[model samples]
Target: MDKAIIVFSRKGLFQKTLSAFDIRSREHARKLWPLVSFDESRQMVTWVSPSFENGRLRRRAHFRVLPTQTSYNPKQHFDNQENHRWNTVKESTEHRLAKELITAEISRRLNYGLGMPWRFKDKDVSNFPFLGNLLLGADRVVRLCCTKI
Candidate 1:
């Protein structure tokens, strides 16, 4: 699944730093919504506390966006496109397990996978694939627009 940054304002549960709930339209930005907050000391972003209950945090993994052939692919050690990208593991393991970060509207809207760029090397890291692989208690749901499902 793709990675997404869910801003959690420290002021309160509903309060947030960023007004709009958005990031790049890429796979990472769409699938995985790791609720997080900005880290001033490290000058980077960090994950926040998730309300998920379980002992399976390690089982959760990052969705590999882009294709294996593309430089933006997280699986590869590419040195480009670091402008808006941030390593979730590098920052902190705060909000890795979210209770219900993704909203119903976004999930339904993303089912089509329309904006996903075709993959030239490997399969695109869209929500369908990501959700299909969602852990038993990962708490996520996604539909595929390309398929009849």
Candidate 2:
């Protein structure tokens, strides 16, 4: 099981065992999970959120990414390297969930009355770096590219 999924499930955000569709969806959440850090001691995972204070909105988080030891064994070193290379290559594949997260984040902020002027539009796309191509269908899809907020 993915470490992030386990942590999120512990937080009641997901089930311990994910279905096929859930597994696919959770994979996207995994990448973003690295942006935050989990506290095993407190059983809390913290990440940045947009907060409004003093008539302004800003990013805030309660915790930072924790460092972990990387174990190395001489016998498995070669195999580990090969596996890491393959995983790196696989990571280049398209990320649909990331785009969806950005759309949801946009909607959440909009609900809080932010980004009112920069509604999803070609002219305003430059301003919102988190957003990408907008796809409209029975289910509205907003393409997004991941970047540091």
Report the number of the highest-TM-score candidate. 2
Give all TM-scores, in the order shown: 0.14, 0.17
Worst 10-residue lDDT window for candidate 2 reads 34-43
Alpha carbon lDDT of each predicted model: 0.34, 0.41
- Cα lDDT tens digits, model 2, 1-149, are 11322334454533343222233333444543422222233222323333668977664323333445232233365578777777765534345566567778766655555543324545554654344333321233345454322
Displacement of residue 77 (Cα, Å) in model 2 is 47
Give the deviation of candidate 1 from the true structure as CA RMSD: 23.6
Candidate 1: TM-score? 0.14
lDDT of 2: 0.41
Top candidate by lDDT: 2
Candidate 1 local lDDT, residue 88: 25
